[model samples]
Target: MPEPLDAALTKVRELLLDPNLTRAVAAGRRRGQRPSVVRAELRPVVLKAGRRLQISTSDGSRPYTRNVAPGTEAGAAVDALLAEPFGNWHVETADATLQLRVTKSGEAQLHRAAADRAGAEPSGHDRTKDYLLDPGDPIFAEIGGSAAKRRQVDAFLRALAATLPDELSGPLRVVDLGCGNAYLTFAAYRYLAQRGVDVELVGVDVREDQRRRNTELAERLGWADRVSFVAGTIADAVVEPAPDLVLALHACDTATDEALARAVRWRSRWVLAAPCCHHDIAAQLRTRPAPPPYDLLTRQGILRERFADVLTDALRAGLLRLHGYRTEVVEFVDSRHTPRNLLIRARRTDGTATGQQRAEYRDLVDQWQVRPRLARLLTEDAPGG
Candidate 1:
C-alpha cells in the first residue's frame, strides 16, 4: 500500500508471542495510529494469537512470520492486537520490498503529555497504558487474561456495539443497577464521555456503604456532574424518564432479574448483566431431588453446579426471549475471586419467538422443580411472560 511514516518496522511480533510487549509497543505508537494518521506499508493479518503475515519487502524476499511458541505471553500479545481495534494500516507495492510507517507529530504530543502528567518518566506513554487504564476505565483491558480471553471480550463488545442505535446523537441515559463499588459503571461513563458521547449515569445498589464510596468516587473523578449514585433495591431506584442502557454486572441471585425487570418496565433498548448466584434453583433442587431423567445427571456434585448454572441462565434467556429480547450467555471472567462469572447479555429485538421456547422453559422448570428468581421477579406484573 503506502507507508505513512518514516519509521521502518522490523518484523512484527505477534501479541501471541509477547502480548505485554506488543501492547506496550502499540501503546507507544498509539498517537500515530489514530484514524487520520497511521500510515504503514506493512502487509500483515491481525490474527487471533500470533499474527500470520506475508509481506514482500524491497529485498524481493517474502516476509513470512509465525509465533509457534504460543505461550502465556504469546496469548497476551494476541490480546493486545485485539485490544487495538483502530490501527490504520495497509501494504506497499505488489513487490512489497520496503515497509513504510507513518505517524503524526500531533499524536506524538498526546502520548508525551499523558506520560508527563502521569509522572512515568522512563516507562514511556506506551508502557504507562496499564497505569492509565486502571486508574479510570479498565473494562476492556481487564476482561481477558490471554489472547483467547480477549476474543471473548471482543465478541461481547461487538454485540453491544451492534445493538446500540447507529446514531448516538444526544447524551446517553444509563442506569447501572446493583452497581456495587460501580467499577463497570464508572468505566462505562468514562468511555462514553471520552468518545465525545454525552452521558448521564446513575448507579443503584442496596448497600449504603457502596453508594457512599461511589458518590465519593464520582466527586474524586470529577464525574459528579455526569454520574450519580442511589442507595436502594435496583427495583426501587428512581430511573427518571427511563434509560437507554441498563447494566447490572455480577448482581447476586435474583438481583439480576430485578434489574432486567426494571429495564423492561422502562423499555430500555440495551441491557447487559453478568449474573452471579443461581441459588434460587439450587434451593429448589434441594427440596425436590428430581425425576428419572434428571436423576442421572444431578447425582454428581460438579454436574449439579454446572447444571444449575446452565438451567438458571437458560431460564433467564427464555424469560427475556419471551419478552421480545435477544439474549446470550457467556463467561465473564476466569478469576476465582468471585463465583458470579457468567455474563448474560440481552438486547431488545422485534423478532417474534417460536412456540417451542416457552414450552421448553416450562418443561425444564417443571422437570427440575426449579422456581427461577426471574419467574418470581416478574410474576406480579409481567403478563404472559
Candidate 2:
C-alpha cells in the first residue's frame, strides 16, 4: 500500500515552492513513451528576464533547458508530468527530503529524509580529469570539434573508465567497431594511457579512407605504436590479440547486432553499443498485422515506429541475457546531442540464462513475429533453442 499519486504530487508542489528546495529530479520513462526525455531536473533560477524554474531534460546525450514562470502553465505542466508513470522521484529541501520509487510490479514506496539532514548539493563536472583528454588538446583542435563535442567525448570516456574492472591485470586491448571518425577510439587510448594503463587500441571501419585518416591522426598524436586503424566490416575485423572491451558507438541498424555478436563470439569482457535506427523492425511490423488487442500500436505510422524501437531493444537485452551477459539499456547522453543516445552496456556475467528468461524471449518474438537481427545473430544454436 502506498500514498496516491496526487498526494505524493501535492508534497512535490509544496517542496517546489519552498525557498530551500535544493534540487529535484524525475526519471525513468514510461513504457512506449516517444519523448527522448528519459530524465529531467528542476532548479530555481533568477535571470535578468525574470524569476523562473529552470527545467532541464536529457535524452541521454545532451541537455536542453527551458524556463517556465511559476504560474498556471507551470502548474499544468507539473500536473501532466505527475500523470506520467515515471518510476522515481527525488526532491530535496533544506530541512527534509521526499523520495518515491515504483517497483517493477507497480508498487510505490515512499521515503523521507531526516529533518536535520542537509539537502544534497549540486554537483559540478570534474575540472581535474587529468586522465581524460583535455578539450583544448591539439588533437581535438586539429579535428575542429566543438566544445560540446569535447564534452560528449569526455563524458563517454568517463563512463567507459568507470566500467573497467579494478581486478583486471595487464594492458587493456580495445577494439572500436564501426569507428567512423575514431574520436572515441583516440580518446579511449589517451584516457587509459594517462592512467598508466597500457592499452592496445584498434579502430575498424568499412571505409579505407576513414582508416587512413584515423591512422594518420594516431601517428600525429604519437600513439602509432599502440593505436592503429583497420579497414574492414565490424563482423570481420581482425585483431591479432582479442579485445577485452568492444565498443560500437552509434552503429546503425543491424550493424549494432553484428558488433555485439562479435563480442559474444570473442568472449569480450565488456560490450557497449549505442544503437542507431530501428528501420528493420518497423518494416516488419508494417508487413504484418499486429496481434489482437495490440492493433492500436501499429495503427499509426509514428506509434508503430516507436513501438518497434522499444521491442527491438527489449529483444536485444533479452538475447544478451541469454548469452550470459548482464545487460542494461540506459541513456548514453542527453538527447540534445543525439536522439540515438540509448546505450546497451553488457558485461559478462557468471551465470547463463534461466529457463524462465528463455521462455520470455521466445514469447516476445512469437507474439511480435519480428525476428530481431541480434536474435538471429546470437541464437542460431542457442541452448534450449
For candidate 2, what is the lDDT? 0.74
Which candidate's lDDT is highest?
2
Per-prediction TM-score: 0.59, 0.64
Tens digit per residue, CA lDDT, model 1, 290-359: 7886686777777777777778888888988888898887666554534556777788885677789888
Model 1 residue runs over 4 Å out of place are 1-167, 335-339, 382-385
User: Which ten contiguous residues of candidate 1 have the minimum total lDDT?
Assistant: 107-116
Could you list the CA RMSD of all candidates, in the order they appear?
14.5, 20.2
Error of 1 at 101 (Å): 35
Query: Which RMSD does model 2 reach against the true structure?
Result: 20.2
Instruction: Please report the candidate that would top TM-score against the real structure.
Output: 2
